[model samples]
Target: METSERIAQRLRQFGELEATTSPLYRRLAPLAAARPELVALLRERRSGQPPANVLLAALQRRLMARPEAPLRGYFATLGGTRAPDDELATAFDAFWPGELDALAGLVRTRRVATNEVRRAAVLRLAYVAVARRLVERERPPTAHLVEIGASAGLLLAWDRFAYRYGSAGFGDPDAPVTLTTTWRGTVPPDPHAPFTVAERLGVDVEPVDLDDPEAAAWLRALIWPEHVERAAAFDAAGAVVRRLGVTVRAADALTFLPGGLDALPGGLPAVVVHAFTVNQFSDAMRRAFDQALGEAARTRPIYRVGLEWAPGGARLELTTYPGGRTTLLARADPHGAWVEPLEDEPATTSR
Candidate 1:
């Protein structure tokens, strides 16, 4: 178990980092950290889960359940018009104690599996780049997209949504869900490039069943109270996913990758993708996953696109197998708000 002082430090750091993006969390996190009660609640979080996010989600879930609760008025997602203020901390303190048991249950069970559909913006750009390269090398532009830790498979439907990157538009113009992202640095691949998703498959340890209201509600609760747009996009994407009937198989990444890659239809390459997923892996598991991919590549080509956090910040990386070349595509927002492409040459590594 983590010490209260350590947990408090994490909360303070989280507040500082989110100061610009989520004003509500920024103000409340530091205040929550000072209260030993709130710190104790966060201490119960499962391993690999972010304590701050877990605490916030638990509080949000309680507010979601009680529509008429006074605390709901403070959350933008819950139709709250009030902005974050000093009184917000007082409101949170009063709200948490009454719902202590429920909040504790939530923090203990839930993982921060926020399936941000906006990430499709980053994935779409990488897919087009990969497709263009494949076409250049005389390979087919079609691919089977397999996502690791794909919650609800919303991102698997990347091609189903329209995107506006700065002035450039991509995907179906008539699509239900449209995502707009800020583009920075060198030009990305042609938005008009041809790339087909032959099929979509997702692997996760415990796949979320959107059909379950409780399960879907947990996902909604995970969204920051300030991000009303994100909540709306999630709902829209869920509708599209349900209509398309996307499937996510419940399995571990290390156990699933080898067979999953081999099972893909022959003649076409596999575009393996993951976003904010590998950070959950233990060091041994990460190494094993890399070995699995390397072993799979010996049989056929595999293109892996990863949007993950490193020491400095989140990166958009494209790693190709057979000759294990890794390209630093861009630095990106964890939630896909923006992308800053790298101008340097691609980096190579021997697998």
Candidate 2:
């Protein structure tokens, strides 16, 4: 297909999928519309042959807009849904012609392209929904969670923010859900009643090494397109992650996780553990990690928590052992952002 047609189609898909009937989506629609030249600019630069960086940089410019010039010494990281198009991959191989890092630089020009990456966002939303489920289901007199994807982990420290739960005041009473966390169910557990994220330990394939300026720039780039608050949150979280230098087992998740399962620290009271939204990896990797957790949990009782995707809705599942059956902790708003527990069933059913 012509590059323009392909780019146009991809843009349309983003418009539909990114909108949530919530403020974020409504705002993104016009933001996208305002950039029509994006399609033509990217398409005109398309090539049927070699010199990879040359071709990609042109198309990439359509999607990216650097905040400043003089990139004389900065580095670029190329992250995206692993689902690279086969044809595009072939072209990339031929074009950049072996200058990998240089090409990553060319590709990292801040394109609207990655915004089309819905799968990861879906996984992220799933994790958030499930965390709420676990909280409500395991409503200890009070509770706190430690998360691993704390990109800003600020979201991990969510209870710290203000929010509304039915009529009662859950958030700080000072802050409200300016982002609109709507839901349709028995309302979720209200906040500030005594919840905290004592800590957040995040792992990334190429973790931003918060101390490194270049890494910090890549982290900033990953912040969602226009959500200034989220962007700020990422910056705050990035600082914490950098300072805390989390027990970040440093390797791609596949290599880092199995040992991480075995290395779980002993002795903690009232701890519910989880991952926010890193489930966008291959099925093989997910299974390997799940198996490792199961094996490790045989003696230890860390709940293997997942706020991951299913077909129609998101779900929260907890597994303490492989033999231990996993339960659907709750069904969440596909887009609304939190999981309220369906606790008609007793919590001890699994415990």
Candidate 3:
């Protein structure tokens, strides 16, 4: 159990972090902080998960279930028209108490697995760069795409979605989902680059099954209340995944990675990718991940495209193994709202 003081501190910090991005969460944080009973709900979170996010997601889940709930007015995703204001706290206070048990269960059992579809924009660029490198080495531009911590495997269908990077466009124009990102610094590799996803597989400890309505609703609830665009993109991507029947295997990434790579047909390289997933890993787990990649690299080349948190911010990076060389591709919004290219050549060592 967390102390009341710790809960309050976490809520305050979370509120500040959301101040610029999510108005509803930003407003609720301080209000939730002031209520000890409300803040204490975070005590049920799983180890290594952020208490504030878990608590908020729990509350949002309840609101999502009860469309008639007054708190729904504060959530734009639920067609809430009321803007963030003082009344937001009253709405939450009224709605949450009635569903305390359900909320607690959700917080305890659910993981915040946001399958942000827009991230395909960043991943597309990284894949293009990887393809260019493969072609330079006189290898096939085909890849067996394997993603770690792929929640619903929505991103695995990246090539199925359309993208617009500034004025340039790529992918199927008639695709169900179209992702656009603000591109910065130097021209991106040929948007017309040849790259093929020969196979798609994702590994996650708790992969969301889009076929299940309850599970899918929880994934939708994980999105911030104000991010209607993200919710729309998610639905579109989910549709694509269901249509394509993408596979997300339920397994721990570190343990499954080597075998997952080895299982793929030889000749076609494996492009291992992940986004906002490594932050959950422990120091030991990270080392094990590196070891797994190193072990996999002995037989065939491995390329890892990651959009993970860096010291500066979230970085879009491509690391090639056997050589262990890393290329700092760009700095990007964790949700793929924008990307600022580094313009530097691929590094000889891991960065």
Comparing 1 and 2 on TM-score, the stronger one: 1
Supply candidate 1's per-residue lDDT for 247.
Answer: 87
Q: Can you give the TM-score per candidate against the true fold?
A: 0.89, 0.54, 0.92
1-351 per-residue lDDT for model 1 (tens digits): 789899999999999985567888888888878988888888888987888888988889889888877778889988899987668867877788889899889988898888999998877768877888789889879888899999899999888899988887877889999999998856754655747888789998889989988889899999998899899999999999899889899999988978778887777788889899998789998878877888888767788888988766588888887667788877878888887777535564444
Which stretches of candidate 1 lie above 4 Å from their native place? Answer: 3-13, 16-20, 34-37, 186-189, 311-313, 343-350
Candidate 2 structure quality by residue, lDDT tens digits, 192-273: 2343334345444533355656445544554343344554445544454445455433456556554554444444222234
TM-score of 3: 0.92
Enumerate clash totals for all models, in the order shown. 0, 12, 0
Could you arrange the candidates by lDDT from highest to lowest?
A: 1, 3, 2
Where does model 2 exceed 4 Å of error?
1-5, 12-106, 109-163, 170-180, 187-200, 209-247, 269-279, 333-338, 344-351
User: Which stretch of 10 consecutive residues in model 2 shows the poorest summed lDDT?
Assistant: 112-121
lDDT of each: 0.84, 0.41, 0.84
What is the model-wide C-alpha lDDT for candidate 1? 0.84
RMSD of 3: 2.1
Candidate 2 similarity to native, TM-score: 0.54
Point out where model 3 deviates above 4 Å.
348-351
